[model samples]
Target: MAKNDGKVIAQNKKANHDYFIEETFEAGLVLQGTEIKSIRAGRVNLKDSFATIRQGEAYINNMHISPYEQGNRFNHEPTRARKLLLHRKQIDKLIGESKQAGYSIVPLKVYIKNGFAKVLIGLGKGKKKYDKREDLKQKQAKRDMDRAIKDR
Candidate 1:
C-alpha cells in the first residue's frame, strides 16, 4: 500500500496561489459520523479553511463538509472547526513556526487514507501581489514553451 493511494476528497487550490508553502504535514481528523459520511461522498470543501495551533493542539477552521442528506437531526454543521490529531512534537514545531512573521498554517487538501480521513496542512508564507504576478508570468512562459515543443 503506497502513500497517496487513497482517494482525494477536496483541495484548496487558492492556498497554492496565495501562499508559498514552506513545509507540509499530514494530520488525522477528529470527525463525527455524519461528517465522515459526507467526506466519503466527496462533499468536502477545503476552500477558505485554515489550521491553527491553539493551547498546544491543532484545529482546522472554516472547513466545510456538507451534511449527509439522510442524517436528519444528526447532521453536522456545514462549516465547523474540527480538531486535528497530531503528535505533540509536530504541534509544537508548527506552533513555533507559525509565530514567525507572515507565516500561517493552511489546510492544503483532504483525503481518505486507509479508510481514515486525513488532511494535508502546510506552513506557508503569504505571497505579495508582485509575487503572484511573477508566478503567473513564469507559468505562462512554461506553458508557451511546452506548446512550442509539442508543435515541432
Candidate 2:
C-alpha cells in the first residue's frame, strides 16, 4: 500500500512576485496537534508570510493557520511565530546569508513530506519596480507564445 504524504495545505504566490529568489531550502515545521488538524482541513494561508533567523534558530512569521473549529481554548494562535527545524550548519548559512546586503529568507511554500510538515524557504532579494514590470512582460510574452503555438 502507498503511504499517505501530508498534502500541500497552501502556498504564497506573492512571495515570488515581490522577490527574486536566489536559492531555496526545505525545513520541518514544529506544529501542534490542533495546528496540524487545521492544516489538513485546508485552513492555512502563506500570504504575507516570511521567515527569520532569530537568536540562534529560525522561525516563521505572519503565516495564518486558522484555528481548529473543534478546538476551543486549545486552539493555537493564527499568527504566532512557528519554529523551523533545520540543521546547525544550515542555520548558520542562513544567518550569514541574511546578513549580507539585500538578502532575505522568505517562506515560499508549505507541504507535507512523509508524515511531517515541510516548508520551502527561499533566499531572496527584493525586486525593484522595473524588475517587476520586466517579469510581468516576460510572463505575458510567454503566454502569448503558448497561445500562438496552440492556435497553429
What tens-digit string does per-residue lDDT give for candidate 2 at 52-129?
988999999999999999998978999999999988988998998999888889888788777678888889999999
lDDT of 2 at 89: 83
| RMSD each, Å | 2.0, 3.6
lDDT of 1 by residue, 63-127 (tens): 99998988989788888899999888889989899999999999988999999999999999999
Evaluated against the true structure, the overall lDDT of model 2 is 0.87
In candidate 1, residue 4 scores what lDDT? Answer: 57
Give lDDT: candidate 1, residue 71: 93
- Quantify all predictions' global Cα lDDT against the true fold: 0.90, 0.87
Each model's TM-score? 0.96, 0.93
